[model samples]
Target: MKWSMRIVMTLTISLVIAVCLSLLPKMDSSIGINSPYHWPSNRIGQVTDNNLPDLLVQVPLQMRIRKVELSSTRMSLDLSLPKNADSTSVYRDLYTIAQTMLMKTKNVNQVWVRVIDYSGVSDNASTQLVLAMVAERESGKDMDKSASELSLIQLEQELQNRFRITYTSKWQQRYPL
Candidate 1:
């Protein structure tokens, strides 16, 4: 009789563990509603009044936005600078300026940017560096590819037109290699 009881206890414990494990995923799904993890939602492309406000013009699947910063200065050849010149300050200034301008752009949902490196100075009394960020487009099944392409192209053109200052020598760490 004692042996039978022990066997029954083991089976009961195993069943309990199995039941708990099965419930874990359902609990996780419930808790994930407010989580930041992007999940595959059945309504990924569903249009609704709430999502309408968030829509920034049907982003494409592969749209890219690049951030560019320029730094330029003039120095005499006699002024010998160190081989590793710290140009962090120059890059920071350019990044701030470019970010501000990009925030005002339309159709682009997000913009990311960073400084690459100092391009270098030329005989024309100018030392310049560049910073940039490439943002990918968030695409959905309901999104229009053509519209997304146009938006990306327009954003690129706008940046070029507005901040097309020539750089003597530019160095960048992150580029679309």
Candidate 2:
């Protein structure tokens, strides 16, 4: 009887250890509520010098681009902002947000970002901003160009798959709120 009890206890302990071990990896991969932010070292999206600084260009804008249209050096992006958010904040947010999105595509250049519309704003909370970005692909096939292009394609696919994956991989480790 004592041996049986010991066996049961051993099994329980083993099962508990196994369960705990299994959870470790999942916890690592699973998106945590308050995870540290991380992003690719490289930066994307260059603010055009010639273009007039509109409500855009503010660093670290809260809004993200919803759509991007490209045409040569001229490009437009539809941005989405948080509720009650300021245009300046949106503008600032655009830089990092655009970098996160455009870094995923190879044929992006001369990005033109704009606050196309405001969506879902609450008097109590900051409004969400939606933005559109339009840009062109740089031309060339040299090794550097080819590499950049490949990176762009890969980044684009990653972003298209899920902005959170790309954005979190690049910036915050936590899931976007």
Full-model lDDT for every candidate: 0.37, 0.43
Error of 1 at 121 (Å): 17
Best by TM-score: 1
lDDT, candidate 1, 62-107, per-residue tens: 2122332222211001112223544433333333333332332223
Query: What's every prediction's RMSD, in angstroms?
Result: 14.2, 16.1
Name the regions of candidate 1 deviating beyond 4 angstroms. 36-112, 115-128, 132-148, 151-153, 160-177
Clash counts for all predictions: 11, 49
In candidate 2 the C-alpha lDDT for residue 169 amounts to 30
Give all TM-scores, in the order shown: 0.35, 0.30
lDDT score of model 1? 0.37
In candidate 2, stretches whose alpha carbon ends up further than 4 angstroms from where it belongs are 1-16, 19-23, 26-59, 64-77, 80-100, 103-114, 119-133, 139-177
